[model samples]
Target chain A: MIATLLVVLQVVVATAITPLLIGVMRQVRARLEGRIGSGVLQPYRDVRKLLAKEPLRAEGSSIILVAAPLVLLVSSLLVVALVPLVTTANIPAVPNDLFVVVSILLIGTVALALLGLDAGTAFGGMGSSRHMMIAALVEPTVLMSVYALSIPVGSSTLSKIVVARGADVTRVVTPAGLLAVVALVVVVLAETGRLPVDNPSTHLELTMIHESMILESAGRDLAWLEVGSWLRLTALLGLVVNLALPWGLADSMQPLALLVAVVTLGVKLLVAGGVIAAAEVFMAKVRLFKVPELLAGSFVLAFLAVTASYLAG
Target chain B: MNPFRLLKLIARTGRIAEPAPAAPVADTEHPIPKALRGSVQVRHVDTGSCNGCEIEIGAAFGGVYDVERYGARLVASPRHADVLAVTGVVTHNMVEPLLRTVEATPRPRLVVAIGDCAHDCGLFAGAYGVAGPVSDFVDVDLEVPGCPPRPEAIVEALRRVTGR
Candidate 1:
């Protein structure tokens, strides 16, 4: 019974805090720019206002256009449910395996890109083309990074990776594991469309990728997209955080352990977000053609990680 | 990446000050906010202007002003807009399109005349091809009067509509 309760709590906490974490990054970016940013609760308010407003559909838009955001929202919810936020073993049905998690996410991305094409707008199609190019490169790197992290523990299960390393204070400091960390960081950055890859804040057509795809959607559809993006950000960051430093993840459902794990997970998620936001401030957006080289570089790191783990372990 | 270097740079140059608080909102002509409890999405229209109001509109979204903080944002389509923000004096050529855009917006729509030109045609009132104030077409819900109103005034108008 307690385990069931923790499972539900895990899902709710991760889902709810997703936007707050995004808000934190925005706030940090604003302060770094020496401006007074919106309050951390701004996402909450934005989502609330969006929910209250009526949605508008384009004249030629179809069921796909309408269903796209729903697909995005469902996948985001699935990801949060699958990711281990509190106890690593309380998952009731979703398998806690690396391959399963990555495959689920890939399906979600593919659906979103396909829906973009269904929007029937030229810009939407163009954004889909660009997004597909990036996703094609991102998938292999994400998988290889997972493989690298699992090498030392001799298991491919996501929870095992966490369980094996959670007690070790220095597992990630070694050369092979550090490569995994770097590779995953790059993958996460690319997946989330953060700076040096794609700028989330800009609407410049010549420079946009993700936001451009959803340009035709408005009102409630746009709101779902916005909230779904936040959930995706937190979900992916949660994976990276769990892999790189599984410290503080609870192995049992004791109330105190769950509480501590929840707090630790929140901190880890925010720190990762802050680091990404900081990277945004420190770097400029690379040109669109230059993105392949960036993804290629991450793939190289992922390759090296796999090579090193075998040689070093 | 050096924290000390960043601090040194910041200490040496204070952050850009907020654009002097928007020209004092002294006009009693600005409409009182309705009992709006939700956010507002604005679709900006430029019937005809010298580009002055657009510049200030940009400033209104810049870091310091951040109209988004008040639960209002600029969207790309009139279909998605809750408030149709018309700028400058409408040209005869623009009158039909302006009305159509406002009509395209969903119900519970609002009309905000963005500047003096939009308010009562401003300096362009007698210009050829001018269609006079936006009121000459659709009913305006709010009026922000300035050749180029400050970002704060624009934000204030939005706040009144959003009840922020």
Candidate 2:
């Protein structure tokens, strides 16, 4: 019963906090540009307005095309439920390996991208192709980085990784751990479409990857896409925090401990958001051709970390 | 020197000055009125384009981009829309549907023109069947331009509509 309650809380919190994280990044970006931005709750308002609008359908859309977005949202929510936030005590975390979590995320991306192609528009097909190429590159780096950390813990379970790191402070300071951190940072950048991988800000046709896939949807459908992206940002950040920070993860079901854990996680996420915004400000979008080199570098770093950890052990 | 501090100052100072009131009562938080509760009603119309933007927009609402949490939703009829978001370019084939959408929607409506096709004609610019621009059909308040903009950008544009 307690576990069930925690799972419920996890979904509620993930849903609620996702927008705030996006808001913080926006606020940070606006501040860097010397402009005051909208309130963090502004996303919530936009979503409300969207829901009240009517939906329109295109002529050529098939059952698969219409159902794809619903599946994408459900899959994302399932992943959010699986990922323990605020407290590890609520969910039985072992069934979900890092590989499994990453795969589910990829499934969501692929499903939506394929739906883009199903739309039968030239841009949709073009966007779908580019999105797949990027995903193909991203998957290996993501797996390799998690494997680097998983080796040190002797298990790929997210909870175990966080628990092992929390129980043993000496592990995180090691050379292998440092390299893994570096690789994970890059993966976050790539997965979230942050600058130096794919810039979310740019509208230039030659550069976009994720944006191209969604050129046809509007109204409430667009709103769901926004919320999902925010949840994704939260989930990725959760991985960075739990794996890299690993401090204060609740080991018990006690309410107070869970509360403290939630606060700690929030602080960590906000800091990451600020750093990302700052980094985006300082960096230009990596040229599309250079993306492969960047992912290759990440793979090498991850490979080195795994080898180093094995040798040290 | 924290960025939030600088932005708040800038936005606050940018506010237009108005006549003084007898008592200045400030509302610290924006209220989620009862009317905005539950699902948000939406009307989506494709002006014209290759169809990539529509797929992404559809994906946003499905399982991945679930917009339901914000008490908003997409309604099938334009008469129900408080928000009107149009995708694709304004093509000759789509002008009737686009205009019909504008006429069907009520007053004080928010119009979001998503994707580069809708914004600046994108790759569909010179096509003979295209109606040229969306502004020719309906008043668009927000333009989310990309070959297809990311869901994150689309949501940001919507947030601006609510004045939240």
State each model's TM-score restricted to chain B. 0.80, 0.71
Strongest candidate by DockQ: 1
Candidate 1 chain A worst ten-residue window by lDDT: A85-94
TM-score of each prediction? 0.90, 0.71
Candidate 2 wrongly placed segments (more than 4 Å): A90-94, B1-164
DockQ of 2: 0.07
What is the per-residue lDDT of model 2 for residues A1-313, given as tens digits with 9 covering 90 to 100? Answer: 6766766777787788787888788667655554444446656666665565544445577775556666677777777776656656535543667877888888788877876787587767876787787788878877887788888789888777778888899987888888888888887778777888877755454566766665555555656666776677788878777778888766567888878877887888888888888667667787778888998898899899989989985
Q: Write the per-residue lDDT of candidate 2 for residues B1-164, one digit (tens) a residue.
A: 56577557656754232221232222336332343333345577877667787777765544334342233356544544667889988878788878877775644466779998888788888888877778767777678888878765565454444322
Q: For candidate 2, what is the DockQ-based docking class?
A: incorrect
Per-prediction DockQ scores?
Answer: 0.35, 0.07
How well is each residue in B1-164 modelled by candidate 1, as lDDT tens digits? 58678767756765543643343343357543332234577888999988999999988877677766566777766755778888989999899999889877755678999999998888887888897889989999888989899888898888777665
| Candidate 2 lDDT score relative to the true structure | 0.70
Residue A104 local lDDT, model 1: 73
Judge candidate 1 at residue A198 and give its lDDT.
86
